[model samples]
Target: MRVLEMLLVTSCVLVLMVSLFRNTINRKIGTIAGIACGSLLAAQLLFEGYRWQMIPVYIVAALLVALLLFRRSKITKPLRFMILALSIVLLGVSVALSVLLPVFHLPKPSGGFSVGTETFHFIDADREETFTEQKGDKRELVVQVWYPAAASGRSGEKNTVFPKDRGLFHTYMQAYSGYLGLPAPALDYWKYSRANSSIHTDLHPAINPYPMVLLSHGMGVGRILHTSQAEHLASHGYIVFAIDHTYSTVVTAFPDKRVTGFLTEQSQDRLFEDSRAILHVWNEDITFVVDQLEKLHSGAVASKFKGMLDMDNIGMMGHSFGGAAAFEAVYSNPRIKAGVNMDGTLFITENRDAMKKPFMFMKSEEFTNINEKQAKYRKTPATDAELKELRLTREQFDNILANRELELKLMDRLSQQGQGRTIYIEGTGHYNFTDLQLYSPLIGLTGMTRSINGTRGAEIVNRYLLEFFNQHLRGTESKLLAGPTEDYPEVKYPNSVYQGE
Candidate 1:
């Protein structure tokens, strides 16, 4: 829950408790103000999600009501009744707003860069082969193919949506608030929901395969997590395939009515090892995909896509654990030309001298900040005015230490090489890299509590990524990436020297 939402709930609880105990006018005022604040907060929670920072406002309001009830006879029974009436109205309105915001227009954040885009799902049986440990399993993989298509023609046939899972995805998505103990999601969860592909596919053909790029999402995240990024690249002529690493994602439901949830990544014994296994599975997946692309380009798939694939040029990319998988794929497969690591901590072991390849790193500012490290104290507010502060046990602290070590070690090798480029987006957290940040504002005080402006941050990061990819993958000479551009002073080119050539 966000700080603000928590505070509001606390305030409401206090008002109710104090009102029941006291017969005074001040206590009544407190009850009214508390109810109003609670209504607003509940609206926020029902609409946006929970945040921690909103508590102060409710606290101040509660205090004011308490003072008025105790000291000001001006706030009579009638005046208190009027305030109570207003509070009730506000509560109703808040509920309505919370419910409408998700389905209706939640204003689009402005100022993001444009890039090529396309998304298509391709089912493959070989996904099972990548899983040696789980061999002979019915390995159905959902491959979201993103590629460069002709600027003026239909790209490929649109894949059919699985009507059954549409509702399920929507339900599970909104249910996140419930799990966090926040108010129920107020909006229609299916508003942004659609088939895996985007609109331009009607005119773009799967033919000109262009350069191939494979994407793997982080743990517990589905393939759609990087939807915007994948589409951007596809529109610009890169065949991008986002692989849903079976059992790595939280849940994957295919058209055939099969659903599988990822084994939790929290288990220590299997965390790193399982992630590595996923990478190898991805490597074989990519290689097989490349083979299929070759056949399709050679007119072998003999369906609607005949002569539209460019199978020769290929690359790989991933986010977080997926980013680490990108490195692992490139390390294992020579066919992968370039790679992009979106602030993922490394899992693969390789020599600093031997592992030389073109790579780019997009890291978050939270990881770089010293004071933002995991806190020792945890707080929770149920209802209002009642705040519970929990002490972090030794185990929690140790877990944090382990995570820090893992992150540091992952970046150490790239830091040593001093060849690749890395950009730490200022004021961004780990979740900021993916589309998860976009969901913050929908959950109320969370947007403010998390300090995520959403608009400027994503724009800056998108520009940086586009500029970097345009320079390296497409061989476009971009001064924006060669060094810091004048417009974006927030981006720093650490560990990379500028060249005059």
Candidate 2:
């Protein structure tokens, strides 16, 4: 909390204590005030709690004080009635924000992949030219591409950003601290805040172009969240380009030293519209990147990337909102031969019916036979925020079952066009598919939260992804997808072999 907020709360508490025992004012109020102030100071020092974000608690105390002040007013006792009414209203609002904001949280560490990987930092002037606002200016995004490199022990691993940006990130987190059980306004306890940098992967000369896959992230999440999956795929011979959608990511820093943080725009139409725009950006970026690789392969520039790209095969995948974007992009762009959706709420688009490419849907527990408590724990962000429109317990659980049903429907639809498949991971939550889980553990931030063991999950998913892509895109046979083997017990594919009725 801020100084002003603290003072307001302190005064309110003191006034309320005195009013509660008006008959024995002097000693009782003094003791109560002393206790309250001492507790506040102690909590601040011991737990590193924030003073500003506790506004809800403070607001309630303030109301209690105001009620007392009303009773003691010089004009009339009727003023007390008005004051009590106003305080009650204010208290209600405070509780509402506390419940709805999700202002505080301690996320579990999903962990990162231990497999080998390499990084390429590209400063795209053309990309800089593409991001134009209405005022005739362009915004450039610094994209870091992670891929598999030769087996050389000389390269070191990359790290993520920390410490310097923690204050800002913490401030932004105040918007949703309540749901996170975080220290109201201060999150100094989080291990990630001071542990490491976001730079993972080593810098080395490109090896094989490998199969290319593009990745998109959820709303308000960074592209780095997909590191576990990306690094794992790269280790197994797949080049992954994770796009950092601007203004949507919590914090995205470009090569030019410019950083654009989250800018809230809540309109559903506008949100998906932005996703579509980003999809176009991603398409153009991938096209340009492939062209660059082609040039390098042709000996145009003195480049290390030589004979490394296999442009004939490409795939795309995304999580949450990005999942919807991936579907839309595949429908609109023929370049994407395959696509996957990771527990995303389908968005409106005119092209879903026209899509002919192979697709997959991997749902969380919410998209399967799971309870709400368990469903929310999964990585899939619940799309129903409106109470009136909320799905019933049975309905919501059935939605997960429905997700599988939809997968079958889509697959049957895809078979009509020639190819399709689906896989559902049961025990995992939403963040399991992302890098944040791994990063969290490195910083000692996992605490009591549940996240997919990023390292293990990455290897499993990447192995399957590579096998799937190779079989479909490169015509390489893979027995892994033929059936569920006992080797991988964590994976439960109820629909893969049986073909859900």
Winner by lDDT: 1
Any idea what lDDT model 2 has? 0.53
- Over 55-154, each residue of candidate 1 has an lDDT whose tens digit, in order, gives 3444444444555445544445665565555554554454444333422222222223122233334556644444336757655566666444444545
Q: What stretches of model 1 exceed 4 Å from their correct place?
A: 1-135, 147-166, 170-187, 190-200, 203-209, 264-266, 303-309, 370-419, 442-452, 496-501
For candidate 1, report its TM-score.
0.64
Models 1 onward score TM values of 0.64, 0.57
Least lDDT summed over 10 consecutive residues: which range in candidate 1?
A: 375-384
Candidate 1: lDDT of 390? 26
TM-score of 2: 0.57
Assess each prediction's global lDDT (C-alpha) against the native: 0.55, 0.53
* Model 1 residue 365 distance off true place after TM-score fit, in angstroms: 1.0
Q: Which run of 10 residues does model 2 get worst, by summed lDDT?
A: 189-198
Per-residue lDDT of candidate 2, residues 231-263 (tens digit): 556555566777766666776665444566666
